[model samples]
Target: MNIDSITNGVVIDHITAGAGMRLYELLGLGELDCSVAIIKNVQSAKMGKKDIIKIDALIPIDFDVIGYVDPGATVNIIRDEKLVEKRTIDMPELLTGVIKCKNPRCITSVEQELDHVFRLTDRAGKVYRCIYCETKAG
Candidate 1:
């Protein structure tokens, strides 16, 4: 599907192919209930299979999701169909309440629906370690 562009809001680009839906959930976009355009399995020169999410409302980004998924993804804020804030997602120093720490022995598992916390161990390596159990994930 070809879209001209969103009149307002933000365009999240360079998303990992399958991670598009997860990104939406991780950021709680479902709760916002806004008009969102999710383009999956799009051809990309840089990334073999990429995705683009265009939200129709002006919503503040949840950077934690970006840090967990593709730290290199770019967030382009659009206003009146004009490029405004173009930011490349950077690996966060610490990640909390974002991704679930994959440690069974970790305290997060003991508590139900506990906010998962992690740390970006290697920015260059795209590695993350659980803050609770200190387990390396993704």
Candidate 2:
């Protein structure tokens, strides 16, 4: 309830209520050495309920991963305990290594060295298809 503000770090805000943990895992935040806080199910006027993630260290984050998990999320950069920049996430057109192709016959399954890639096929539906076998991502 009393989370301190970060001086130099990134804050991921407006995450879909239940999607924060998935985003956290996919982004590999658990592997970082810095302090990170995940606040879930916070009341939000706009979203009804939302999740927030605060990182206590400035580190490189793959925006594509955030976009893929929660396109409506926002990223805030803080420096000197002040907001330096704010970014609204959008679905990415291409995803590489963010998700693995599930198709058993897909080349990625056989060729372990190849990167699992997907392309946005339907923006309206947020459908992603594996580039290797055109298998729709689940």
Candidate 3:
């Protein structure tokens, strides 16, 4: 109810109501020493109900992971208490290290150092398949 405005940081907005925590963990915000806020199920006119993550620090974010998890999310950059930039997320065509191939036979599973790579196979359905074994990403 009384969330303080960030002086310089990013505000991740319009998260699909329950996906805030997933986004928070996936982004490795837990490793940071800065203040981070996860606001869930907030009333929204455009989205009906939404989740928001407010990072009280400016840091590099993996857009691919964010897009893959929640394509409808938005990122707002706040600088000096003013919104400086706003970004709308869309599904990524290619993803690397954003998700893992669940297939046990996938080369990535055997090669511990190999990056988990996936390509968009069905845009409308948001389907992605592993590049090595063609295993569908869950």
TM-score of each: 0.84, 0.97, 0.96
Structure candidate 3, residue pairs in collision: none
Residue-level lDDT of model 1, residues 15-117, one tens digit each, is 9898899888788888877788889999999999998988988898987678668776789999988998898887788887776777789998889777877
lDDT of each: 0.83, 0.93, 0.92
**1 against 2, candidate with superior lDDT:** 2
Q: What's model 3's lDDT at 5?
A: 88
Clashing pairs in 1: none
**Global Cα lDDT for candidate 2:** 0.93
Clashes of each: 0, 0, 0
State which candidate, 1 or 3, has the greater TM-score: 3
Which has the better TM-score: candidate 2, or candidate 3? 2
Badly placed stretches (over 4 Å) of model 2 are none
Task: Report the Cα lDDT for candidate 3.
Answer: 0.92
Top of the candidates by TM-score: 2
By summed lDDT, which 10 consecutive residues of candidate 2 come out lowest? Answer: 60-69
Error of 2 at 73 (Å): 0.3
